[model samples]
Target: MIDFLPMTREDMVERGWDQLDFLFISGDAYVDHPSFGPAIICRLLEKYGHKVGIIAQPDWRSTSDFKQLGKPRLGVLVSAGNLDSMLNKYTAAKKYRSTDNYSPGGQAGLRPERATLVYCNRIREVWKDVPLIIGGIEASLRRFAHYDYWSDSVRRSILIDSRADLLIYGMGEKQIKDLSTQLSTGMCIRNIRDIPGTCYRTESLEHLWDYIEIPSYQNVAKNKQEFANAFKIQYLEQDPIRGKTIVQNHGEQYVVQNPPAMPLTTGEMDEIYDLPYQRTYHPVYEAAGGVPAIQEVKFSIVSHRGCYGSCSFCALYAHQGRIIQSRSKESILREAGQLVKLPDFKGYIHDVGGPTANFRQPACEQQANRGTCRGKQCLFPSACKNLNTNHSEYLELLRAVRQIPGIKKVFVRSGLRYDYLLAAGDREFLRELCEHHVSGQLKVAPEHVSQKVTQLMGKAGKETYLKFKKAYEQTNRDLGKEQYLVPYFMSSHPGAGLKEAVELAEFLRDTGYHPEQVQDFIPTPGSLSTCMYYTGINPLTNEKVYVAKTPHDKQLQRALLQYRNPKNYDLVYEALIKTGRRDLIGYEQHCLIRPPQTKQLSSRQPRPEKTDKPGKQRRLTPTRNKTAKKQAR
Candidate 1:
């Protein structure tokens, strides 16, 4: 009993013949996106009668839309680091290559039918033998054996390059309902690799754990990679999990790991934001008769979930758990009364909240480990009370989602830590959470304005975003109204060098917020700002701080924190007059110049080994108005 979705296309043409059924496929491109983790596995497989279909955001170059959503059906759910790979060439031929299709929103392009896992291997070359299975967060952070900031390369083991027959990974509806009751009482998919959040396809390295009851590998022989380093591993192709050798019993340590991931239930997240959605846009022009209502509006809820603000370039405190966990203000006013009965129902509500919806519990209510923070900031010097700083129950869950019904405005539009709500004194519940969940602009990250780069980037204190930008501008001029606060800014993190990215581009040019879209740090894989951007000194602050950790010094300190044109000032004055960094050459062509890039080195010629062969990876381009120096003729 665990699914709750599939609105029409004939409710998947009447259970499209249950045979070998279970097709969830989400590679996370936020499809018609409702998610309480895909509506409790599509309403618990139609409440136990079994027959599901939710291929959301999957145009993995058509396997006839997974053969019209059913048939010879049984396995294929994929998550664990959910899809994004098509090396360069924006939408090469196109099927799915978006990561905000290259704007200032975190790079990810490749789609010459390169949709996640090459559009699931062209739908397994036309369903050759079915059973794909991958699981979310881009297949649980690339499933194992990592290091690949857009092909900086170490790769292997996303169950061996998406040739996936299995790999369920964390927080999936109890191992996708026990692999659909062991493939409906028959179980192929290789005798279902001992189920549980499965990882499958065995033989030479067999070992399965029947779901870890502890002790299979000869009892903790030197704590198996420190107990496989806190189970946050991710891979879709990096391998090495098979027999990296360890087999013990009796004190318990069979140690191969990869199973225990359940998590979900606020009534399956209010039946996934109260199901029945219709948010479209060019869904072939709302199937003719038009109603694109600027991308078929409405439907975007989440009242809350994990995130106690671990934020050292977040992985959501090791994948969702810093604990804020909400939902209940009449279950978010019954999902805003089913998102105002669609028909592109945009009376506006885009966000309900989570991660920072004014954190409600855990910076103090005890969930200890209190270890690991090797510097990407937060050496913890404020915001205490168990770090779950309150929001007076998110201001009564945003005043019962602004008294629902035909809702015309509920917007909290996520993110507003502003130094843990001024260390949880709650400044009158952050001024009634921005005069009742702001809309005309509120975003807020203040990622860095320098208090030693906001404590090396864990955040809070740079005068706590100017005391919540002066009590959110005197409560929007004492409610005469007119919002605006936006402010996110991140520029070259990991103890931001180049003198703290030019004192954070002169503190976003004295707060007028110019060229302000800046993030450029990308450490990724379970970030602590990728261990201070691969070791520049923060092994627990033996502090030698200074890291722009290369990519041409993180694109010249994120182009001088969003520097303005003048041909990015002759490529930041020939890469800062060849790294002598001549004080950012009078702040380059002004209007907040960038200046860094001057290399002409030929010290009489001998350059070759720039990087080739082995895992073969140069890839990542996206530099746009290239500072040119071309050579591969």
Candidate 2:
């Protein structure tokens, strides 16, 4: 059972509740996914015997929820993850004719949205002394100094904005555990500086500490306006092992130091993966029916942490680190066994992946360092030099899962690293994958088409994706069955604008798989890419780029990903004409307004399918696979 920290100070007084195990003020509606930060932290707190309550959709517009979720007996955890907030525009841009243009769930701002700080400020209004602990993508991404795209200016550190006592970045399991245990014992917040994975401002106390190394990507010390200029940090947590400044909280006088990044060791990784979890999939659709469990499969198993394919937009590398760490095989399998025994026992496991699912322990274990990562994510722009690209251990792990009694099928639903899949000594392994693994679809994130875009994302060559595609096709044919690589991509990223997005659209249009759902880039405050989005330059490379920042241009840029969706037609047309984006107009109109070639033929001959279906499908294949072949060519 969880409590929603209610609104009103008297109500807090009314509850008259004494000390609590833990207090949780959340940005999410409490969907329990381990990778979904708040849930993991809450569950972990419970594991530590801390009673926790939450404030879902903490409508800053209304302060009622505050009265109920009073100050913590132990401390407070503020996470706006799952259903979290960022620097998304609280107001809508120009409304499209169709309501389909609304920004996805969390991006368009709170229904009566306010910034996290606003929410935190509202809470402090009721209980100012409550120890506030903050983490989650929203907070973590903005933990350091960052450029606020919506405000068109630099912003101060998230600690200043949210008014939290301490900000815990990354996956936060271990760090949070330590924070909770330490605070419960009456350790002052200022004393938490020495703890690993924590960032806090401290009062100068006779410099009572050893070399307190700060991180290179540590929170930027800038005022709100100058803050936007602070968007250079990349990995939110330690992706490898590195750091920046150790300021004395009393005065500005501080020791600016960067520690060698500490990567997660294999044993530490195991503790994370082995945490108890309920993997049963709760279908959102089924809840409406009162049937309880949805028809979808739930494969509740834990994961070893760390992912190396650090996509610029992803926060996993920051939280989990890039090094692969796993719990004992017995521990993972044990969880698998528990899921199989659930009421609607299934013979399959839905997924067993993280970051880039198949990535395993560092390829070469002989390196001087085992885990070396700074919270600034590395998996996004590139694999770490110390990354274990080897898939042998992973293959064995998957193989072992299949041997579980009830697991008739164990699929790799997590997207695969296609580039890594194509490496030498790995093709045979990949070939073996198609032969043995794979349920129906193997998700792959060839995030974009343009080499320029892929380069920006630290992805492998377009050739790598193409080779994987060809090999996959070849493998499927050899196995004599049809399977697919469901590719995942994003729209409106920092490096993408109308031309790039359209080029991607054209690629998709030619390939015949125009995505209907696309991710509009949300310039989360702390991401390196967010810095580039606001500053028009890659901080890492210090290179300038043309950014699509206006509302109208952003809409068109986002719409390009789903050019075939009828709902996007109106907006795309307006976007194209206004932005001088004629190149994308034809495809936009053709897909959204005009009928397809098949539709034209069908109109002429109602029964053409009986006689011309074969040829027609052949004609469609080129267009369908054209995007697919772009890399091959």
Candidate 3:
């Protein structure tokens, strides 16, 4: 019978199982959605005929709560929910968040500060000898020695801290399954260290055949340059086929990381998604209010996994890898068809994409055979020469989904790789996107407009975004649609000084697009940008780069994005003066903000003329044109 995994002892008995083979512990409340990692791993184990039970958000203060489901015969699996615990509970400024959408009733502080380590520690206290395996975004990203933004120190690999017998680094499907099978067959955890996409602690390298040893934990911690060098080596070895066995020394022992798992074939993705998932939180949480994280994804579909658009600020490369694995059209359609039958079906599919919405296949044909090139990116600094930029397959998939009987709309809310879209020879996809998928607004991340900053971000330069902007506007005009491109921007990233922040302010002013919300650069672990933030040097080139670390400097950079807001007037003024662009503070027609004033300023800021109307170009009065000509002379 298809049912939710056993969450309690009664549940275990209800399943007619004497004991579970695995007891999966997580920080977030039990959610069976595919987007949830614990759910996917547990369900995959169940599919393999192993009985699994879930212990969601157990009390970390004591081990009593962990005893609810009882111990497992094979091992105990742990994860820090969907997000990193520290990242989920705190902000970039090191402030606690009051709400956690992943929790039941959307409550905060249900889980401890460092969830992965806490959960693993608690599991050890209860069942000392059971195999402890940790996976998920938190564990995956922290699989190696890296910088911790919150603590402001170089921490050892999570494998060493959590004391998990085995750490599955990437998407864990292949690794966990293989590891579980071995454990069930009576193989010890220490003997199963050679599995790809996993990490383990070893006393000596004698057991390892071929491996690349990174700088020891002490060395990376003592010297910033060594830290950067170690990060560079780890970054280069993430590919599934080309990646090597990366090892790092912790004091007396070593932590060894196996190469990433290969991307799942389309049939594999189909089988995983087709599992018997309840697609909602356990009924016990219904009174407290179900999980708030399911709202956006309940009716949506994950079209693919992995991203080639390797934004430096993102952790997809560290967690999902760079390979793009898409589900077949039949599988996506099947999921859409199922969504239509849901009691709350609203005739709208919230999204139909993954890491990148439009990316359906590998960036090039050779990636499947040779794996992605470790050093070179497919679409950064400019699209690579070997990149195969195409959108026909994705366009066709959208068309097929739209034709499903009860589906009224299919929106691509996931971030779209605008540079990749622009590079494609087919404008038909753009036309189709503008015509159907968009629901009055399409959001894309431009991050920054300055070439230096964008390059540091590992994103395409502003020229590419501008080209895409022009094309998007033209497409909207041709389709007679009034949709708006709500571009997302980030501030205070490494390499973004006052100069770069002011450049972004000017772009916002010139475009007449005032973002209601702007993201400040957050240095999450396992990203190249985080390396720069911690070391003040680009690991790729070993060149010194400016990072805005002070609270005041970060505030100024953020204000520059919203320069028109009166609340940010002082910060914006300070940034303008600091950048030596004080001329923009006046009351001129093109000025970003007016000079300081005691009285309250109007909330409505002057916008670019062309932006006020659809399909209209900015026009200057004859007198104003003459004034401009005289000024030029």
Best by TM-score: 3
Q: Which regions of candidate 1 fall more than 4 Å away from where they truly are?
A: 1-17, 20-33, 40-74, 79-129, 138-140, 143-274, 277-300, 303-312, 315-335, 339-414, 417-450, 453-461, 469-528, 531-534, 537-633
lDDT of 1: 0.52
> Could you give candidate 1's per-residue lDDT for residues 306-383 as a string of tens digits?
664566677665445443445557766766776687666767877777757665444443333332222222225564
Please give the ranking of all candidate structures by lDDT, highest first, separated by commas: 3, 2, 1
Across 1-633, the per-residue lDDT of candidate 2 in tens digits comes to 113232334334555645456767665444444444555676678778776665555667666776565566767777664423433233224232121111222233433333467767777887778787777666665655556655666555567667677877666776777788888789987566655666675444364444443322233333321223333333332433434433322134232212223555566555554555443222331343321121232454445566666676665655655666666666667677777788777687777766566665554464235344433333434444544567777777888888888778776766677766654347667776787678756667787877777777667755676778778878888889677666677776767766677677666655545444565666655555666676667656667766677777777877767544455666656655665655543323233323332222222211112221111222345564465334323
Error of 1 at 17 (Å): 4.2
lDDT of 3 by residue, 1-633 (tens): 237888888888877788889999999999888988888999999999899999899888888889998889999989998999999999988999989999999999899987999998888888889999999999999988889999999999999999889999888898977888898789988899778899899898987777898898999898999999999999888899988998899988799998999899999999889988888888889998899999989988999999988899998988888999989999999999989988989899989999899889988999988999978988877788888887888999999999999999989899988888878867899999989899887888989999899999998888888898899889999988888887888999999999988889888777767765789988999999999999999999999999999999999999888776678888888888787887987656677876665213323343234332322434567876576445434
Winner by lDDT between candidate 3 and candidate 1: 3
At residue 395, give the lDDT of candidate 1: 77
> Cα deviation in Å at residue 109, candidate 3?
0.6
CA RMSD (A), model 1: 24.6
**How much does each candidate deviate from the true structure in C-alpha RMSD?**
24.6, 7.8, 4.1
- Which model, 2 or 3, shows the larger TM-score? 3
lDDT winner: 3
The C-alpha stretches of model 2 lying farther than 4 A from their native spots are 1-19, 31-36, 46-64, 67-71, 87-115, 203-240, 246-297, 300-302, 363-387, 497-506, 509-512, 555-633
* Model 2 lowest lDDT segment of ten: 605-614
